[model samples]
Target: MNPKWWKESIVYQIYPISFMDSNGDGKGDLRGIISKLDYLQELGVDVIWVCPIYKSPNHDNGYDISDYCDIMKEFGTMDDFDRLLQNMHARGMKLMMDLVLNHTSHEHPWFVESRASKDNPKRDFYIWRKGKNGGPPNNWESYFSGSVWELDPQTDEYYLHLYSKYQPDLNWDNPAVIDKLHEMVHWWLKKGVDGFRFDAIAHIVKKEGYPDAHNPSGATTVRAYDMFSNLENVHTLLQNLYDKVLFHYDIMTVGETSGLGPEQALDYVGDGRRELNMTFQFEHMNLDAASPGSGRWDVVPWKLTDLKQIISNWQTVLHGRGWNANYLCNHDQPRSVSRFGNDLYYRIPSAKMLATFIHMLEGTPYIYQGEEIGMTNIALESIDDYRDVETLNYYEEKRQQGVPEEEIMSAIHRKSRDNARTPMQWEDAHEGGFTTGTPWLRVNSNYAEINAANAVKDPDSIYHYYKKLIELRKKHKVIVYGEYGLLLPDHPEIYAYIRTLEDQRLLVILNFFDKEPVFELPADMKQGGMQLLLSNYQAPKNDDLTQLKLRPYEARIYLQQLEGK
Candidate 1:
């Protein structure tokens, strides 16, 4: 196994706008993050992946970048960013910036010039096609809802935007565009940035001939996943990116591959592939949809068996082939404890259980902001309380389709991105100690009980459990490079696995439900001396593993020394 620092590192994602607010501006700034370096250092993370802080119109919460080289004014100036980087490096932590290379904001100078006139030098910077049938070039749907094409009356043409219309897709086929993006990446590397988390990377290359996707359900718009995701040419583009820029810098790169599976993922991050270090696959993230291929908003009860299958597939497929980026939730997904764990009844044990599952997996584990303290999803009273563009668009679309307001609100409560976008609960003070001024989004009403201040003080808090998990990873190579094996694969409530690295072995047993489940250990697996490594609940009095009854939302880890070591 390759021994890289990032491979063994734990990543903590920081959505800057909601992380911390400095100067009472109702927004998180670089200075705010600077003040909390000690806090993160205490959490024992090796790398911090801060979301986009570049110049943007806030149309997509900083994802729509208007300037790659400049910092968003609300996030503070370039000097503040420099100071933030300096402080992070001083404290032995690395910084990973979010790179949105697939598209640029419409207000960007290149796009502005591209839309000016057909003969302009930058006219080819963005994908543009003449309108067909007096409508969009294709019936493809925007990821945020509505048509992917936006008509520009100036030149009687339409531009392709896989996301919001303000975020126009860049023409990667154009060499000048590729060159400019590569230069921007080099500039950041020169500025001492350690790595990049590429956003919407699989959608960078579009299929040949803007073909209309077949909508079997006959919806007005269709998600043309095959047309824009993981195209044959994307690998070539990524190779060029790696050879020209990323290869020179010792940096970590993880691509957000939305519509990819484990087999296809190998093409991007395989041992010899020069594309990326790892990929954030969405297969497991989509298991809760109402049906196959249904969008995230169409919620359904997720099965433990299905989750186990998905995770086991990824783990086994990428064990020695490629790398995996293990995560349950991020800025785009709902909180993990609320979605997968019993947030109300067993929040503490469930949160630790989920943490143990991910941290013990064969990959670099990412802790979304506030996840360590067991943050739960927030349900705003009305749609107006939400601020995410995706949530608002879904709400309007469903409302126009005659769906009742209550039904739409219920779906939003379950799946809206804003649930993860709320300001971090720092304390029980005003606005969860996120800001002295009005927060951009409403703080969760339960913040008084679930703030980080209380978690830090309590030794048994989820925050400390996460700290211990990270420390264990640092001390044991088995957690990082151990080969993974699934146990009790068909069990309904127990998700168990074994990690083996030569003579050392670790067994992890998790109870996925709110009821106690009995797990029977196979006779062949009981030949070693077992030692309790960790557990969410108190250690059981009996060390026998023959027929163990696990508590609700319980998690246990055991280390075995074969032949008395």
Candidate 2:
């Protein structure tokens, strides 16, 4: 496979609101990020993806943008952002900005005009429909639940909002809207950004009729996802945008796709087809569910095979035809340590194991803020401690639905947005060194024990493990472009894979369980002369290769230099 710069790079995602606070304003800003460029450089990451810093109402934690051209005052001025971009480039790193084009805050000028009289030209810029029988336009449901259409007092019509009522979905069917979005893309590209991380990119198109779905969850309202995502015309719109504005610019465009299958992913990211470089799929992230229905977020024990299958499936499917955005945790989810692996028992080893697991595979790896230090989910004592809009909404919704407080707390404990949105634990200080004053969100209680300051100093820390992983990917092209083959498909706890290009071959072997496992080399794996290059655990010299003993969560990287016969 031909190599692209992003193909061989690792992206580090910074939830700017929680990363670092230089001014002690209890909020992380651009100056704070500027001061930490050296820290990111040490991590060996190639790209820094900053979540939305655009002007916002903060209704959905800055996802609802009021303006595409302006940076949020809390985040600092556009000049500060420019300095961050320049500093990142000076350190040989690229920058990717979060693009939230699906919806805009109601306070935005466009939305203001859109909500005016129905005959106004700007009204068509947003989805609007007449009320059905003097009620809501349709039974469409918002992602936050309830009616997707919000009544506009001015026009006496309802506007479509796939998310919060405060965020109205844009009318992408309008050519003027398309032109404006393209202008916004070019505007950022002109500022020297490497590319964009599209927010809910699949929802850009909706079924014209706004049809309702007969979902099994007893949901009488139509799923907005069905109405707005993976529509027939969505790919054509993306292809036009890619071909005209993105593909020729050498930019890295990754789409956030909610309900996409392998075939859909291929259509979006097929080799040089000009739609997207990669996409974020939620299949793996949803594996820990206990029940099959909505509001059933009890933690279910996960098998090592479950994770293996998820990763291996994407790897096999995207080996050559397309690409994937490999990740364990992002801003939208809880930390991987608490959710995916046993943090209390095998924190460090499992953290290192996950680092090896994701970074060693093909595609671009995105490391969420502070994940390298093995940050676990915060244990909130009271519901009052939670500040996330989603969590609060769910809590209130459950209460109104007659669910007991205990059950609501249980759900919150398992799947709170606060789990991933807490302030960055920079050091073992009173405020986790996140800020001098109290953070906008509470710092996790374990910050003193597990944080960036201590991890950077420790040679054997999970932070360094990730650093080394990034360095390996930068140094070896095969790790990026090599074909992926799962060597032991049915192996219960032993995960192994091979990456080969011409004569150079690399083998990755990982033991997922805590107890030691004796793993026999597969028939295809040559036993006699494989040289071990790297291991997350200590390896004994002259050890038998045929029957290898792997310590709990131990991972080894082997390289074979085959000379031409």
Candidate 3:
């Protein structure tokens, strides 16, 4: 196994716009993060993944970059960012910046020059094509749920944007564009940045001829957009980036890969292949996603076996040849505690149980901000409270189709990205101690009951529980290099797995629901020598490793040594 610092490190994701607001601008900024270094150090994270603070129009909340080199004024100056980076390094923490290369905002200087005239030197910097039969260039639609092509009145041609109309897709065919991206990367590496998280990189390469996808229903769906990702040159582009920039520095690069399965993963993240260190797989996240030919509006019921299969498949396949990025929630998804656990009654236990299940796997685990404090999803009283472009667009379109506003809000509560973007609950004061000014987004109303100030004071709070788990990963090489084997794969409520390294073994069992279920310990682990390493409950009922009845959201980790050891 690769024994690099990155492999051993635990990453904490910070949605910069919502983390903390210093100077009372009602927004999170670089200085706000600087003030919380001690808190992160106490949490035992080795790395911090800060979302984009680059100059942007915020059409997609910083995903739409206007200037890659300058810091967003709302987020503080470039000097403030430099101070944040230096302070983190001084505290023995690494910082990874988010890299959004798929597209650029319409306000970007490059796109401005490109759209100025048909023969402008930068015209080919973006994808522009003539209309086909007086309609769009093809039947392809943007991921935001409309035609992919946006008509340009000045040039009489349409430009492609996979996300929003204001964010135009870059034409990778232009060598100048490629050269410029490489130069920018080298510039950042020279500044002593740790690494980058490549955003939506799978869509950088498009299929040739831009053929129409063969969908009979003509409904807007993920499959329509999936057809544009993981194209023929995807690997070539990554390998070139590796040769040009990544090989020279000891940096970690993880791609936000979509539309990639086990077969394609080996090519993108294979060891010694000069590509990426790891990539976030979407298959597990898609478990709650709709079934075939359906959109995100149609939420589905998933089985325990279904989730286990996807997790086990990736763990086994990527064990030898590559690595995986372990996570349950992030900036673009709902809170893991609310989505996967029972947040109403057993929020704390279920949060810790979920943590034990994911952190013990053979990968680097990531904790989103506020996750350690057991944050739950908030119900926005009205659509006006949400700042996400996706949610607003979804509400507008679904309303036009005769969907009730209440039904749309129900789905939004279940799936909107805003659920994860609420201001951090630092203390029980107004605005959850996030800012002195009115927050850019609404703070969750339950912050008074679930704020960090209370958690830090309580010895048994979820925050402390997470700190113990992070410390275990740092001390036990077994957790980082162990072989993974899923146990009781068909079990309905108990999620169980075993991690093995020669003479050492760790068995992790988590009750996924809020009900007692009898779990018969596997016969192989029934031997009397095993030690109870940890449990979520103060005292576990399963004293002996025989037939055991688990309480609601119970988590147990038992350790066993081989005969010779």
lDDT sort, best first: 1, 3, 2
Candidates in order have lDDT scores of: 0.93, 0.84, 0.89
For residues 1-565, could you state the per-residue lDDT of candidate 2 as single tens digits?
8778888888999999999998888999999999999999988888999999999988888899999999998899999999999999999999999998889999889989877787777898999988887778777777777788898888788998888999899999899999999999988898899999999888988887876666666655755566677787888999988877886688898999977766679889998677998999887776776744243255676666776787788888888899889998988888887776668988998888878888888889999998889988887878899987778878887899899998888878778878988999889997899899878989988888999999999998999888888888877877888788887777788888888777777788888778777767666556336877677775554356678888878888877765661
Over 4 Å off, model 3: 219-223
Cα lDDT tens digits for candidate 3, 378-415 = 88989999999988999998999999989999999998
TM-score-better candidate, 1 vs 3: 1
Off by over 4 Å in 1: none
- Say which prediction, candidate 1 or candidate 2, comes out ahead on TM-score: 1
TM-score ranking from best candidate downward? 1, 3, 2
Residue 167 Cα positional deviation in candidate 2, in Å, after optimal superposition: 1.1
Model 2 TM-score (2 dp): 0.96
CA-RMSD of model 1: 1.0
Compared with the true structure, the alpha-carbon lDDT of candidate 1 equals: 0.93
> Of the candidates shown, which would achieve the greatest lDDT relative to the real structure?
1
